[model samples]
Target chain A: MLEKSLKGNLGYWAWVLFLLGIIGVGVICYIVQYNYGLGATGMSRDVTWGIYISQFTFLVGVAAGGLMLVLPYYLHHYKDFARITILGEFMAIASVAMCMLFIMADLGQPMRALNVVLHPTPNSMLFYDMIVLSGYLFLNVVCGWVVLHSEYKGIKYPNWVKPFIYISIPWAVSIHTVTAFLYCGLPGRHFWLTAILAPRFLASAFAAGPCLLMVIALIMKRTTKFDIGRVAQDKLVTIIGYAALLNFFFLGCEIFVAYYSTIPGHMHTLDYLYFGLADHATGQVYNNLVPFMLSSVVMGFAGIGLIFVSRYLKSDPLLALSCLLIFVSFWIDKGLGLVLGGFVPNGLEQITEYVPTFVELGITAGVWATGFFIITVLYKIAISVKLENEKTA
Target chain B: MDSSRRKFLKIAGITAVAGIGAPSALNMLMKQEVQASSAGDGHGAQPAAHGGEGGHGAAPVGKRYGMVIDAVKFHENPGMAEKCIEACHSYYNVPDFGNKKDEIKWLWQVPFTNAFPGDESHYKKDDRTHAMQFMVLCNHCDNPPCVRACPTKATFKNADGMVMMDFHRCIGCRFCMAACPYGARSFNWRDPRGSKDGVPFIKKVNPEFPTRMRGVVEKCSFCDLRVKRGLIPLCVEATGDSKAMVFGDLNDPNSEISQVLKARFTIQRKPSLGTMPSVFYII
Candidate 1:
């Protein structure tokens, strides 16, 4: 028993050391980013936002992914969801921490972030995004704490927790919607200037977020004695598959309308992102390849195919690996394509491109590592408490 | 909870819809102003706003520094505006090259016809093929979108009728740059406080209109510093006796701009976009 505990304890410290190495390097990069400026990053006129914004966009979806489990288990009375609800809440807490970090890394002056609250502009969607993201973070924290506390004490949670859970479901949807609004509502951005952007964002979030959870659940089942259970895991995979299909369908509709109508404003933005519009002279290509188009195609096909692998998704380890790969692919496609594609051949028709410098990359790596660190520490405490409670029971 | 609910319902009903409606209404107000400015061309000689009260008490003191550009003369002088652009850029500490994402500017010329889209399109490109006249600087519009979009209130239309930027307060989101139809705004992607080709740029950083740091928006303020010191806008001075660029007030009938407006048929750029640009073009 002592040796077993030591193995677990050693694993924990090793993970901690790994995290520290990443965070330490990341912090150094962040310092450089602070001392210099956003110009240290690969962002430019045609791509005002680059990797940082994309990371933030992906993390918000990941953060909202928790609602998939929370909603079905709490509101809809899926008893099987009880086993994974705590995991969902913890995943949310981790994802939100990542989301906030990604946003900080993107800002030219991260220190002045408090000014968003100090001088609030109700007209700006950014203000709403701030409120919802923070509120959701708070709600998840409280809900997770209360549920975990009840388990520790071997007692039912106070009735107050129910309302918080209910609030979280809609709040999850709101956080992603407001995030979508950050892009969609901007004027002169033809690609993002869409009515269905919010819904499409929601669909992608539902698909990608839950798919990540399914992979984590599978990992838990394999390495540890903890079992998320086959039924619970299978149901989530199916749900994610359906959501991915919807995301693809809506994306198809957007493409169809843009291409068929042939309105220059709408058509040009899509063409720039997907196929090189007008000329190769006008397009943004790094390493002689259009990064967004290739990544989007690869991810799109893999995601759709993996989701349709019903039996494989339910039982096979390969299916779980496919989900993880597709989830990452979808994230890359969404981040690069959605934000940077909007600004190429900027309003003035100036075609200068952007690439993040070393400082920018360092800051980005630091932000990502910091996110993982938050998740690891949070999860360690949560799992320890759950294990302790299980021993007592 | 009931009271909060009631308040939420009312605000959500009114302000949310109003929030969406406000930009459109603002756009219309701008359109009307542009239309009024265009029609004023038929009226009078000129009354300089600064010419009242002997440059003293209330001196009717404030300058409504508007510009009336002659498009036909632009064909006469190929690069006249470049002098004015150089003068303003020099004073403002705007960098010449580097990160296209964040670069500052005081004035740069845009084609006079493409710059002014609202007028009757009687003049074709081939008719005036030699050279295109340019719209020089900020219009200092009655309803300025830059000020509205600025989160820090860093960009505000001053009491003196200049659309000014407070560099110290700018957080550099560049929404103002994106929102401006004429693409009049610029950002400092890097510290522009350096020397290029052994010529020192940003020698004297003005405190009132402070020199900007990296990643903050800056734009033409109609030479706010010059106007504050009782000088005709640097651009107007550069145009010098060819008197190609006219500067004065629309508010006062005695202003040079007003006199020129009454004498010449002038046009503003993209009046359809409804930015109510104060700068005008005369053919």
Candidate 2:
């Protein structure tokens, strides 16, 4: 089964090599960052967290998004999803791996990361985040491997795998919820203090995660004999469509609460993100994220609208385009906008804009490449097993 | 085959439980031992005797330390805040990164509005009040968000009500930085002891205090080292006038800080957030 990844065409090897090249670049950049400290990145005292944290946050949702498929297929016995559940689990394994890497990259002392476990403070949300994420990663690895191995052996999956699959359903929700608690529980961070933050994270994650899987499924359909049946793909799109709507609705609720309350504390971060927050004394407006945030809102609606339309959903190219749009939209909202927006008009009401350095971008790209590499190999193996099973039958 | 699998599961379960349970049990034991030793040293036993007397020997424990800043007095005495900041930085060997981005500050000043953002009063009639700068530092809150956020107890609230940081244990996640409402903590973005163009970041080294390494969050430990040596914080010492900056036990009602709070109307920054800041400003 492991040898399945080793057997690939020229194109497959080329793609693998491309991912490896990006990873190599990332390793070099990380080495420089390791020596120079986080000072090598553009993050400052004001924006203590930047690209690394934002990516970690976004990827957590992508990882948890696997729950959408797992829950429906496993719990409801949705037969249409049976073919693609392995894909969701494998993607989750890869996404969780990236989330962990992003967290490590963000740490100022990467080596001391084990301290979180050694001297675990249950009170800290990060402590729980570490537990859930690693636990989810472990669950996905065990469940995916056991099920796939059993499938390769042409037998029913072991009964022991049932309880693990059942636990993973709720565990998925906990990972994102704990990640949200990391921000929402903090005092004086007006942007993330809202009660709906966890729900918002879940909604965006559901939308973005499945949308990404849909796009990947479409790509696999073109590239390989693996077709995650049209019915399953359409159902996934329906899930993504509703989740995107809910995500936007939550965003609207946040905006309404911020504006209707007329509290400067609640409204100031939003103002800075959408409409530049003006310094009353200096008459200087900080609106670095205004363009990105506004575009996110536009892309989110446009993407959701395209997917919801029956005509576009029927068209593969258009559906793929819509998914890419929604995925990018959520990426901006969660990956770029949310974290940066929270920090702007910082605790002292002074705005310091964050722009990631080339080194930061290189390292981020490296992490993404690593995730792709993992999924590429995992998917290749899954597809090979499926094809082999189909021929045998 | 079934028996072998069940046996493997049994061994794995024991290993897993031991792996997680051992450290936690040891941590609890270590905490109790520390408490027992401190209690034996009389630091935790007799709280009433060590109240504002600036007790000799080990710093007074089982006390809530607090600071009261006389804002009006600070305003009257120009350059007082600057001197205090200088004293704190020099004493602690806090590096000058030569730029605000990487700057490390234990104590600093911000404009009146910035210091007390909750005060939303518009159109200040007096230019003096408008232009006033308030000294700000770690609040060392009774409900410290940083302590609650630190995954490793690297930053913990001492029995004396001072928030202390163990630089060695800090994983540099910056969760404490995001958690701190006051923006009190600063991450060592670069090695504090390192040099640039043949010039050391810390011009004068303070042998008494350990300079921190790169990638650790640090802030005012309320001069924990100085306090342990039975001396007041450097900022309070720099002020020279006892009325300008008061430091004493909040638990002892007879203490100067407690007396100041009783006599004057003092405000803590972002009191609405309910951090219960130990530092108070007399407006």
Candidate 3:
């Protein structure tokens, strides 16, 4: 099965080499950061977490999004999903791997990370996050590999693997919920204190995760003999449509609560993110994040609207465009806007802006390249095996 | 079932229970033994009834140390805050990174509006409150959010209610910095002992204190080492006035800090958050 990844056409090998080149550049940047400390990045005392942490948060949702395929197929016995379930599991494995790498890149002392395990503090949300993330990664790797192996051999998956599949359904939810707790449970951080944070995370994850899967499936359809039937693709678009709608509804609820309640602490971060907050003393306004945040809202609605329209949904290129829109919308919202918004008008009511250095950008690109590299290899194996199985049958 | 099989099952159950329970039971006993020995040493064994009146040798055990600052006195003395800040930084060997982005300070000052953000009053200005600046530092809160958020227990609350950091154990995750509502913690973004572009970050080295390495979070330990040696914190000593900055055991009613609280109207930063700050300001 592993040998299938080794046997690829010139184009496949070229794509793999391109990703490797990006990864190599990233490693060199990381070595510089390792020697110079986090000072090599643009993060400061005010904005303690920059791109690395934001990427980690967004990828957690993508990893948990794999549940959309696993839950419906396994629990409800939906056979329409049978052909593409392995794709979700493999994607999850890649996403979780990226998440762990992002966390490492964010740490000031990457080597001492094991201290969280050696001296585990049950009280910390991070402690629980470590447990759930690693557990989910383990669950996905075992479940994905074993199921794919059994399918390649043309036999029913082992009965023992069933319990793991069942546990994974809830484990996926735990990973994102714990990530939400890491922010929401903190004191004085008004932006993330809302009770709706976890639900919002899941909703965005459901929308963005499946949207990405659909885009990948469409790509596979064009590039290879793997056609994930029109029915399955349409069903996925439906799931993505409702989830994106819920995500926006939750955002509206947050806005309403912040404005109607009229608490200055609650409203100030929102003001800074959207309308720009004015310093009462100096009269200077900080509004760097306004354009990015507004664009996220605009793209979110436009993407969902396009997908829901019957005419556009019937067109493959239009649907792919819509999926890309929603995916990028959530990426900006969760990956860029959320973390930066929380830190602005920092604890002392002073605004300090963050801009990532070239080194930081290089490292971030490296992590993404690594994620795509893993995805390409895994997907190639799965597609090749499926095509072979179809020919024999 | 057969008698041999039943006997084997009974033995296995006992061994499994012992395997799970013996280490924990031993751990509990070991902790008690340490407590007993420390009590015998008289390090923190004295009763609160003794109080600060008994002088340095008779300092009370199981105490909640606190500080009281007279805002009016600070207003009268313009340069006093700078002096105190200087004393603390030098004592701690805190590095000067030469920029705000990487600056480290154990104590500092902020404008009245920034220090007490909840007070949004427009017309309540009086002589004492006019253009006021407050000295800010780690509150050493009774319910410290940093302690609850530290994944490695690197930042912990001591028996005396002081939030202390073990720099060696800190993974530099900065979660503590985010958890702290007061913005009390600072991370060593670069090596404090190292130089940059042929310029040294630390100009003068304090041989008395250990300079921290890069990639660790540090903050005021309430001068716990000095306090342990029966000396007050460096900042309090720098003020040169007993009432200007008072430090004593809050648990002891007869202590000077307790007396100051009883006699004056005091306020704390963000008291509504319920962190129960040990530092109070007399307005």
Candidate 4:
């Protein structure tokens, strides 16, 4: 199975070479930043967090996608998902790996990260997030490798792996929950202070992650001999449909809480994001997020609408388009709106917009390329095993 | 159903429930342990309370130090503002990036509009003449959100109620910056010992206090060092005779800060948020 990744066709080699190219450029940029200091990036006193932290948040949710398959299979004993559970677990491993890399990139002194362990502070939400994320990563590596190895060998999975599989179900939820706690518990950031933040994070993660799983499954169907079957595909569509609705419902709840409460703290971030700040209407200042957030909202609603239409939903192109919309919508929401919303009209009520430098974008692309590369190699192994099983059948 | 089946169900059910409750429960217990350990005078591992040791501490023990500012005095005598800022920045070695976008500040003045926002009727006589600029610093909050947010106990409150920073321990996550209600914390975007054009950025490093590295958060120390030596905060001393800034113990009735708080109409920033900022403005 491991050899399968090495002996891929020319197209696979090309993909691996492409990802390697990104890593090369990113390493050069990282060296410049490491020597010059954080001043090399566009981050300042006001907008401390930038695209790095934003991507970290989004990927944590992406990593949580594994549970969609795990929950259905184990908790409900839904045999349909049993075939694809390994796919979700493998994706979790890649996504979590990316999540860790993004956090390391965001750190000012990445070397000093050991201080979190040397002097632990449990009260800090980050302490908990780090613990859970690392723990979850370990769980997935053990569970995913063992399960996949057993399948490739055409043998029953060892009984010892059961506890890890079960532990990962709840551990998956904890990782995302702790990630939300990182934002929501902050005092001054009105955008993320809501108690519903964890639920909202989980909901969006469910939609985006499984939607990704569906994309992967669809790709495998086309490119390889492995398919998850029509029944599982329909089940995933249903999962995406309901999860998208729940994600939007939770978002609506956030809007209602912010508007009805009339606390300027709560309303400010949303107002700045969705509707352009009227204060900026002096025509002097501009809230650039307005257009991006508006597009996200429109696409989000459209994605949800398309998911409900049975005729359109049944079509592969339509479903893929719908998932693409949902993916882009949440990606922008978490990336630009949620992360930057907390910073604009910053703690001092001063408007300081953050614009990332080219160097920052290069580093971000490198991180994404690394993630995609991991996903490709892992899926290659997964599909080869699936093909072998099919041949045996 | 065999005995093994019933035993498996019992163990699995308990494990599920414990796993769900463990994180929050562990968090609560850790918080209690932390609070219990750092009970009196937030910093220091002196097993006993203040009276047990360090009894001859120059700054009064068991007292939260606070400051009251006469906005009018500083507004009228503008030189006092410069002197005060120079005194604090020089003492702390806070970098002067010479650009507003990259500005690093410890104590600085903000216009009344930005400082005490949403209060339209702040100035009765004239906006320009009456309390135009207000000085702001770390609150040394009663419930310091920054302290809670710091994963390392790098930034902590001392027994004297001054917020302290352990530069070596901070991982530079900037979580404290997000948690603070007032924009008090600043990260070293560039090295404070900056190298400029093949020359040393800092020609003469302040030897009295050690300079910090590029990857840590720093803020107003409330002049804890001077207070330990029984001297007033440098800002208060530098303002000279006019006494633009008054620093004293809030707990002692005889202390100047307490007396000023009782006598004048003073206001702290964002008191409604319950951060209990120790810096107050005397209108």
Q: How many collisions per candidate?
A: 16, 0, 0, 1
- List model 2 lDDT by residue over A340-391, tens digit each: 8898777888788899999999999999999999999999999899889988
Q: Is candidate 2 or candidate 3 better by lDDT?
A: 2
Model 3 chain B: which ten-residue window has the lowest total lDDT?
A: B49-58
| Candidate 3 residue spans exceeding 4 A from truth | A310-313, B1-61, B122-124, B127-130
| Best-matching candidate per lDDT | 2
Q: Each prediction's DockQ?
A: 0.17, 0.68, 0.48, 0.38
User: Which tens-of-lDDT digit does each residue in A132-198 have in candidate 3?
Assistant: 9988998998898889888899888999899999999999999999999999988788999888999
Which is the better candidate, 1 or 2, if ranked by TM-score? 2
Proportion of true contacts reproduced by candidate 1: 0.23
Decoy 4 TM-score against native: 0.89
TM-score of B chain for each model? 0.69, 0.84, 0.79, 0.77
Encode model 2's per-residue lDDT on B1-283: one tens digit a residue.
3999979998998899689768867887897798788889885654533332232222344578889988878899999999999999998899998997898898998887788775857227567767777899999887788988999999987658788999999999999999999999999998999999999999999998899999999999898777777899999999996478999888788988888889898888998887778899986
- As a whole number from 0 to 100, the lDDT of residue B36 in candidate 1 is 73
Better of 3 and 4 by DockQ: 3
Ranking of candidates on DockQ, top first: 2, 3, 4, 1
- Tens-digit lDDT track for model 1 on A267-326? 766766666655322344432126656776677667667656745635457667667766
Model 4: which docking level applies?
A: acceptable
lDDT of 1 at B276: 60
